[model samples]
Target chain A: MWKKSSDRFEYLQTLVTEFQDTDIEEAKEQVLANLANFAYDPKNMEYLKQLQVTDLFLDMLTEENENFVEFGMGGLCNLSMDPECRDIILQNSGISLVTNCLSSQREETVLSAITTLMSLLTPLSRSEITHPSILHCMLRFSLSESPRLRNLAAVFLQDCCTEEQVAQAEQQMQGQQTAVGIPLPQD
Target chain B: MAAPVGNSSGCWSVPEVYKHHEQRKVCISRPKYREGRKEKAVKVYTINLESRYVMVQGVPAIGVMTELIQLCALYGVVEEYRPLDEYPAEEFTEVYLVKFQKLTSARAAKRHMDEKSFYGGVLHVCYVPEYETVEDTRLKLQDRRRYVIRTAQNRAREKEKQERSNEDPTTSDTTTTTEMTIVEYDKTCDSDNTGEAQQTSYMSHYSSFPPLPLPPQEHNFYGHTNQQGNIQTEDKMGTLHNAIINTKQQLQKSTSFSQNSSDRDRGTEQRVTPNQASAVRFVPRTAHLENRKRKMAKEATEISLTDVSGKNEPLIGPKLPEPPKLDMEDVSLNTTVSLIRNTMKQVESVPDLKPLEKKIKPRRRI
Candidate 1:
């Protein structure tokens, strides 16, 4: 069993190395997919951590390639549940990177980002997560057309914010309503 | 922005807080104790039993307060209903917090109404706990949501781990080694070789057959068809030859006139020209035409036989005598006797039916 795990680790190490060295988008995508698959197992967390795959995923978040962001967020979402992985992500400012992913057009990327945020939520990081802009985005997301996004945003709102804060936010929204221009006529 | 800042200040604004508190007065509201005025405290009325407040989830996007109240009224008297409108209009449909007149009704609503489909979504109805405010409920929901997500993640991870561990150690090690080697090869291979490497790797994973050799570029089009045509022609010729030989032997053995005709037809069709031995490409088309012609001839024979039989048969059959009438009275009597006997046997078998019949007959007569 130990040997099997070590072999798997070696395979993952090779993949990560290939991912870094390969300039071909397709090869990078394949390696990212494999890494993401491996990331789903908790037992592989030690190997992944040893290989510093968490940093690799974090790096992919800022890539121009949407697939990289998607697979990266997926891996982070899977690994974020692990305390060690969570700490590494947190130390690497993964919250901002993940928060940036909310604007992603890809639904899966957005979902993985949301779940990763949920997984990484700590009392200390609550302020950063509950920043006004993030809160506003989540509030809008709570009304999203997609049920998954809505429910996830609702969960974020319920879990992350207090009622007082929500009410306060609502009141702010109402007050800002009047400051904007006049309402346009509806068709 | 001004509104949020104003609302933030409104939290400290005593009158606004009071106004907000006023809306929930009919429902159970937590009382505030006077700090200094312990002596001669005024009497307060509080319902001793649990409050009739129910939190109803899964409201449809277009649902209104009245519709919710009407739906809840089926179980009990809904005193009031308020849809939580904290979310923006675009974000989510409103979820209702309903208050009933009685605790029994609230409990009944929770039991019968919970998890029922409201519109397109399932309803989640439950009594509001005494101490948990909306904020606390949200917090609890958040915690439950986290727990659920974590559990799901753990389950997925455990399943993947189990799958990995269940695999044969030797095979998995070899597979990993091969996969690593392929990845390494892919890295070292030039762009032109990358496609071939990928194809080879894919074949290695799924198939034992060696990767097929690429066709020469000059012969790409006809190369495939030439191979296919040769195999097909060889199969068709062998089958046709065997069939012809068997039919000819059968014809030599048969003494029937129709068999003789069919044998002549077969012999004419089977007469090979000088080019027939090398005419593999033309065989399939000629064979198809011969088969069709034979089918047509058989169909014509069948049609002629059917027509001759129809011409020889009469158009209508001779009339027949009517069936005898049943003796209704005798049949009814027999059935009644048999039914009574069956019932009597049933009564004898189980004596309990006798007393039941006795009570039932009296009631019927009365």
Candidate 2:
């Protein structure tokens, strides 16, 4: 069984390369379909996960965007550990992908994706988030028409706001100790 | 020799298609099927990204269809890049950028590739029809999307029916009970799967989080994801990837291609849809952006000091010759607090010094 999976792993790497070939469009479909079957099958999924094949699957597939969204949250969560994986997600997927994932009509899936993307950022990146467009998207995402989507985007947006709020809270605590009334400055 | 070209700094094998400025050949060392050969870890793929997207959707209206031109051209192209100079000569070419972009969305990109032959595939080389605007692209995609999804949906239903028929008769009879269960495959979740993405919201602490598992249902979620998210995610990623590849290919295609290639869409800004705020704009939470916020905070402190310094001249100058020094500490955090504490300490110490001064001054005066 182990050997079979290892063989499949080796085969998947080849499939990914072959999938890249321009002439193998049907083969590409077959490869992804096969991988998808493996991905969807619970028995295989356990072994695949143990092998940490999600990362490879992400790398090899390179282009299964929407399918990835369902477990995007989990993918992002898993990627949070592997810095390279996280960077690839951010770089390839980018903010647009992030936003689209958040705003997806598939509320539960996109919510997880959005929140997970937000988590993937290192603390430094998390603190400095300032894309005004992201702010706008967050609003639309909150109105995601799906409660699950709304909450997910909200959680993500709130996470983005955390650093600023943390700084503000620290500032307010300092003001209370002073002799005279010191106003807590707002940004 | 004069320009000084040779092996790159890395020890591993690099997949170079060519050597000199003249003849470019990519010597990609295939991974050794045998064990223990060195140079196996180097990832030769131009883009080291895992997984891309494909979304195919019915454009409800021609109005939305108008957005297709931008979508068609810009969807899967690499948005972030340094420049062509960053890559080794002939070793890297963007010729397949568009086709590779289709890889992001298997079906949607495939559909687009079907219409526009970016390469000489099994069917023979074909040219993608030109789209001028989002609407043009959308109209084209809408027509294709409608046909694709319907066909896909039909296929999916048939496949499900077949699978159901193949199941054990005893289990099939229990329509209410599902024998299948959702499960996690590995340490990582596809995250790309929208079904599992929904539950990720459960972890809000943003620390020690887990990944989404595959969704279990009557329908094979993966089977339908192409029909569902394919045009959306796949089409976008494929177009964008193609745009990047095409840009490179065109540069190689003709001298005129450079002008067109340089005219690559400023899709970066358009692609960045800030959460909840297309009206407000979304800021990516990256380290540089975070550091920028810190710098902004520091600047705000300086501005506040400038204002306070402007007001401070009259009230502090005469009484406090050291006012400038204290004012200097205004914008700083820890130091400023310390300065204020020291100032208050000096104020307390003043009374104690007066009695000692009285004794010393009287003796001196006498």
Clashes of each: 3, 119
The all-Cα superposition gives candidate 1 an RMSD in Å to the true structure of 37.9
Evaluate model 2: give its TM-score.
0.26
Error of 2 at B290 (Å): 28
What is the DockQ of the complex in model 1? 0.01
Runs in model 1 with CA error above 4 Å? A1-3, A181-187, B1-366
Model number with the top lDDT: 1
Task: Calculate DockQ per candidate and list them.
Answer: 0.01, 0.04
Best by TM-score: 1
Across all candidates, what is each one's fraction of true contacts kept? Answer: 0.00, 0.00
Query: Could you give candidate 1's per-residue lDDT for residues B5-40 as a string of tens digits?
Result: 121221121111111111121211212311111221
> When superposed on Cα atoms, how far off is each prediction in RMSD?
37.9, 24.9
Q: For residues B270-360, what per-residue lDDT tens digits would candidate 2 score against the true structure?
A: 2223311431222221234433554465566436434542112111111110112212333565455566655655654221111101111
Chain A, model 2: TM: 0.50
lDDT of 1: 0.48
